[model samples]
Target: MTTSATQRQAAASVKSRPPRIADRLPAEGENGVFTESWFPLCKSSEIAPGEMRGFGFLDGRVVVMRDRQGEVHVLSAYCPHVGADLSVGKVVGDQIQCAFHEWRFNTDGYVAATAIGDPAPKACLFKYPSADKYGVIWAFNGETPWWEIPDFDKPADALAIRVEYDVPIYPIDPWVICANTPDWQHIKIVHKIAFDHKQYRDCLVWNNYSMQGRLDGYYTDNKGGALETKAGIFGTSIFMMQGNIGGRWIGVMTPFGIPKPGHTSTYFILATEKGDGSPADQQIVDQTLAGLYHLAKVQVGEDKPILRTIKYAPGYLTASDAMLAKYLKLVREFPRSHAGGEYIR
Candidate 1:
């Protein structure tokens, strides 16, 4: 059996990438970052008013801060004056005061004041277009964002109770995570869950996001009163579920790529329809909600082991892989992050 030179080179390339998250920049002609898309900067609840914190984005870190008025801002973490981590500094009024030199930076990234109590030069920092929605702070990697986060099927003003769960870093590209949403075979086999699922391509009405769709599944292990659970996926970043048993419940996973390439973190953001209840009944409702949250957490846990050892290579396809093939095509066509523009983080 002779292995051709091309085949040997392909094997070697796969071997080169360590199991750890890919940290190296993509070689020339590779699309490393998807621009004109929203990458989560931080959770809205985590950044309190008059507070500043840093979170990883794209291939670098961005500092998220809430001003006194509770407006969130995302910007480069470094102080352009002296390279100090701006997140470590304090927020004064609507601006951040750098600890190293007391330099002040406004939400617009302009140098407000210098260390010597003088107006600074024209040097300014980079600011990203950010918005607070879906219990997360979203920033556009490219300016003039091409798409906005889509809303759930529910009403625009429904009182959805949001509970967010922080997921640990997993070593996988964002696309890989999104691809798992429509894996019907994995549901019936690996997870031991059974349900009817049909993956669809994003076309007219919902062309805002990528090629991923809903998973309508119910746990086969359970006895009578089968629970009705519905999931919605938008790209690789957001996975959502609406479950009905004793009450209505919804869960969303808003994932974002970190400064480390090929590594991503997810927020298992959960929500429930606010049921009217008295103090005594509210406690019972809370307990039930806790169980649902745990279930959602467990489902996310099941994916980690698979991602840790997965490789990017050609696979023998069958009729079952029909949807996955389309999903990959959408991922490939995703726009690349550009070097200029406000989004070039």
Candidate 2:
């Protein structure tokens, strides 16, 4: 077929147009990584006292170390001089010994020791706030995290069962990828979750959320009660809360620091209330465990394939998307990361 003159002109115009990034990403732009939230960085054993570990990402890298008193500190990685890896260094008491030239840096990232006659430059490491909660190490991009990681009531007094996904490293941003929780219609279509009209009617979103519907093919019990889930989220961490929300699963899937744009490692943990430790309570535990197993081992298999290929673009949502809409509103309104310096909390 021969092209018309108008079509040829359009093609030419398209070729001349400069390429640009899509606006589907959050407005935080390149600065989005340093957000005002706590990110799951590592596990407790990963950085015990007198140990140092380093990690890298798209936004920036960080070095995790523990002092003599077992207090953990997460700081921007890389030695100011020669760009040496601070993680490979040794932890001597309250400081990290640089592998490149034996320069010792205190927990504050300041130069603590140098060779005789060597000048102690007025340089220091940039530090972010860090904490250990929910069996994970969280690092805040800012000195003061805006909110604390949500926890259940009397968790230690409960029966906690954990299930994990060898979740493949997906290329999407955590905030964008996690928006599926509120896209109830998609959950029905994508994960085989069954949400009837009333369940959809019960839709709501605040700091947390609840789903009063049947998990359908996701459990042996298949009871709507077993499927009902209460959830907590703050882009840095999102999960189906159990003990706190009267659900079969209580777990989290979160990321680390957002110094720059990058993907995060997500995980899961489930808990059941150990009331009286009676056989009836144990039965509930068994049922909850089975429900979580299907969600983690079987049902999640359905989500991974779609999650990896999802794109951030214009969305056409329906009434059932109330949760996702509110979730995005919160994500969009979060403040930027605090200025670089000492972490307070």
Candidate 3:
């Protein structure tokens, strides 16, 4: 059948339409197969020496353990033999001893010995590259870490830090939440931060895995206090900022975790410079950090409602959205993988 001129014109118009945001952005295969980024597994103090704990990680499960020598290791949770949960197992010397079969696996995740007294088989668990830093245990997504764990510009011991791992969980991808950093409009409108837009636009730094922005302004609270801010998002999951807020020096690091697809848990690391080793000075530092943490929570409360309900389609982006636009681009090209496979379960 031959098409009419009008019919041909309609088909041509349809083909010329721009693709949707989903199509435009690079696709990450599945929710479980996440981008190659550092994921905060648990607090360092939670897993004491000679203790093992299982956590629901990325798409599956992992065990964080501390050997007798005080070395920390994060390996896939279930045992290679009989699928016993290693978290319930005991730590023997520098190895993991399975509770069910008495099989022993070392920090390298290879079976050190078998309960039956026979030579151990060639089975091994997936040992995730992990680091204990900033009072948290972090694991990288792929076999090797893309970059070092995020840290403040100042030395850690010089700062008084309070890490809150039980912050509210967001029912969304971690990247979606991290988009907050580059979202200038959201910062200005929702968080009440006022800064010179032209200066900020000129001074913003963009890199492959991170973005940093500086703002000098005042918080539009009733008092209109002076504020100078420096903020950055690293690896699509960790958001960190340090600056003077209302004449107080504060630093914050929030790294997100994925228990599974469509769910994210946030960790808050609040810090300020430590004072002189005196009772009065300690009290002042404590109060300053406490107040800083409270402000962090308040900001989270402000963003919670909108983030929870956002469909997040960038249909009509404006100039104010340039930073968010860059973040989305970084997410598109970021590496992704289900690194541990079935052993993580």
Candidate 4:
């Protein structure tokens, strides 16, 4: 057969297959930085008052420090003077004192003092927009954050929050993991979640920076129970779920971090409403949170096999995949920047 006829025969024979597409969505557009989203660096407990720790971030590094006054700060890791890793230094009062020359740097990323007594050179560290929330320390990629970290409807003080951070890093882009939120099929198949018969267009409420929907049904897994979940995927790196499990209120917040390209770190924030200030009430609240934590672990465990190996391309999507399609579009349009490159290096 001729080349054209052979091509026609191949097309006619193929029934269904993954469509040709990009490997993964664009994380860094023309700007050469990960999407402008809040990235969790480490747990708040890791950096105690008057302590500092360094972490690998999007194509760079950062140091997290808590001052003597118990305020947390995130800044570029390397010192301007002779390029020392500031995390090796000591936290002196509100400033970080570089171990090399004992150069003291303030939270604003400017040189505060130098042990050598020379006029402190006009040097500065890249101070990332940082926050301590959901039991994790987070830093935004851009100079200013587009939005704050999301919270449950109730005030934080009204809730009991427990954070778990021992999860293994996944060999996938952060956004690819966030895609699981709208992947209804995976929800039903992997996590045994059976949602009521409602389409994405009917349930999803999309916004500029987030999308949320409610799923109501029972887990089809052997240990079945009723599930009423309201979940949101925010800024390509955070997921929040408020739900009723076993007739009790449960809340989960999962934030993803990119240690570098093709790798993701995660934290689990499990929460429940506070009860009356009685020992018995506290015990009940504790048990509820423990159950929620176990559930979160089980669901994530189910996802590990696929996420670690997925070379994500939307491929042959159907009408049922409308939610995933919408999410991908938002990810592409999301802002990106490498503003900290100069200093974080």
Candidate 5:
């Protein structure tokens, strides 16, 4: 073969070779493993008093329950003795008693009690580093301790209206929703807004974004609407749209994702009209929840299946997917294991 033919064959061979697994994974040095960051796993309402529920978050099975004092505790679903599911146990006072062998664990995951005949288990159930903040339970599944849970308390306090809708989780990776916030073209096409064209046109240009460590923030057009929104993508959580609407309505989208062993679930808390003097009365909260449920059923339900089918091609990104790239970048920076960090309640 001629020299050119030989060079062409070598290039083709290199192209045909399978890429390394490390290349397929998110860049570790840049994004860090996500397991260490604080991620909102479940709403406080989801864990009723004395009820133990199994959930997936941080790519593992976690059992969360509320004690008689109304505080939440999260630990491995499996018991150390005989591998029974801790979720099946009863919540007694602050301790969770294993239904199988009656091994009990306290709120801090210490072995409180065990059966007389059973040998003391050498290993304890893996306890998740958790904190209760803003009516939600935040857990860290990574190797390093999360510094501080992102504060949603201020927004929650400011809103005159607070709404929570328990819509069916769209079976899509959390990144899809993260990507949607900044994707302007999809808003006009999918949402079908009949609003101002100039706003939509300007948002498509990626001009306002700043990244600091694990957090990144950006502002985009609310599709010519009265809403001006900003999104702060933190590790796996989304803190989006923290601005006023119509000079009165303050809105924020605090998005969270929890990964189970077999599936993933996501939810958001929308607080509007923040910093207003009016309190979120019971009636207002109720109405907000109802409206959110309706809106989610229409919007998230529509986006769910479509997002579920999206394929993430390795090393392929377009300028239009700037938000997604930013999200992926943050994800890569989180730690995979909890090495050292204090657990705050």
Candidate 6:
């Protein structure tokens, strides 16, 4: 018997539903949502010339290093030759020499030179596209060609301040912190701040509703006259806030997952630019960083325990989770082959 076209279509639809095992498995685009874009990976200072830094990103292990020429290169940390970590290897000229057998790979991750008695490796280490901008290094893992990478550049006139620190919460997916900025109720409950307080309460409420309304604009409302706003791509958001209280203070938060599954982290930086002729400008910048660090410890540190303990279920969502809903929607709609996965673990 021949199946009709309608019957074939129905069969195809059924095949597309995620399998039962997928309940615990994050959607392709859901876990490490990868789009045709650039996500900041690290500060320029973090990877110095002739230095190799191992990083866990996009659910996989990647190594970032600068050659003697001072150019940056990113590649899979695992050596394709023997599964050795490339980070332990040293940079010889433009090639990375593997520590195990001294096998060298060029900036493009192609096998450049193999030591004696070594058979030509079947495959070369995977190379990730990377670029430098705004004094930061960005890595791309999308399936599309490198030419398709998105341009991520900040304005030259914009006051830039860069701050870096390691959060103690490891293995706790970074999206939790990334999503926290848009989560309104948490600020009051977790941070234990009076949501009704004039400056604090008003700004929180505005940011919460603004994000819900999907308004793509800057928001600057704080006791210190700081402005914090974010931009969204697909369902992910990049936060940028700057305020000129005593001096110009800027903050940026970008979230990314590892190349594999089961890992995520956010890269946060705060920069304070000194204003001209402002006698108190330097002090203001210093105070701002100090104040922000304290706030981060209280707000982010407190959320760590709660977020880590909560059971994660992909489809388990609530009406109050507006940002979560938007995030999931973006995951469902975008290509996930390389994008970060869903917010849920």
Q: Give me the candidate number with maximum TM-score.
A: 4
**Candidate 5 or 4, higher TM-score:** 4
For model 2, the stretches where C-alpha displacement exceeds 4 angstroms are: 1-23, 27-33, 117-119, 157-165, 196-225, 243-260, 273-294, 338-345
Could you tell me which 10 consecutive residues in candidate 2 have the lowest summed lDDT? 208-217
Off by over 4 Å in 5: 1-34, 117-122, 152-167, 184-224, 273-297, 314-324, 338-345
Best of the candidates, lDDT: 4
Candidate 3 error regions (>4 Å): 1-32, 222-224
Ranking by TM-score: 4, 3, 1, 2, 5, 6
Candidate 2 lDDT by residue in tens digits, 1-345 = 457988998999999987764436463335533446666666666777788787653366778888889888887777776677787888887988888888888888788877454888988778777886655667765656666666664555555554353556666666665566666666667655554634443544455222222222232334223344444455534554432223334543433333345565665655555557788877777776566555565555667787678776536655766666666766666566545522211
Q: Quote the positional error of residue 59 for candidate 6 in Å.
A: 4.5
Tens digit of per-residue lDDT, candidate 3, span 258-280: 87666788888888889997999
In the predicted model 2, the residue pairs found to clash are 33-258, 59-259, 59-260
For model 5, residues 97-179, the per-residue Cα lDDT tens digits are 88987888877677776767565555566676777665667676553354655443354555544435344554544544555
Residue 218 of model 3, lDDT score: 77
Candidate 4: Cα lDDT at 227: 74
Compared with the true structure, all predictions reach lDDT values of: 0.64, 0.60, 0.82, 0.85, 0.55, 0.54
List where candidate 1 sits over 4 angstroms from the true fold.
1-32, 155-157, 160-162, 198-208, 211-214, 223-230, 243-249, 257-259, 338-345
TM-score of 3: 0.90
Model 1 lowest lDDT segment of ten: 199-208
lDDT by residue (tens digit), candidate 6, 157-177:
443455454444344344434
TM-score of each: 0.80, 0.75, 0.90, 0.92, 0.68, 0.66
Candidate 6's TM-score:
0.66
Residue-wise C-alpha lDDT for candidate 1, range 235-332, written one tens digit per residue: 54655555564445554445554445667666655555555767775765566557666766666667778876777542565688666665555565
Alpha-carbon error at 212 in model 5, in Å? Answer: 9.6
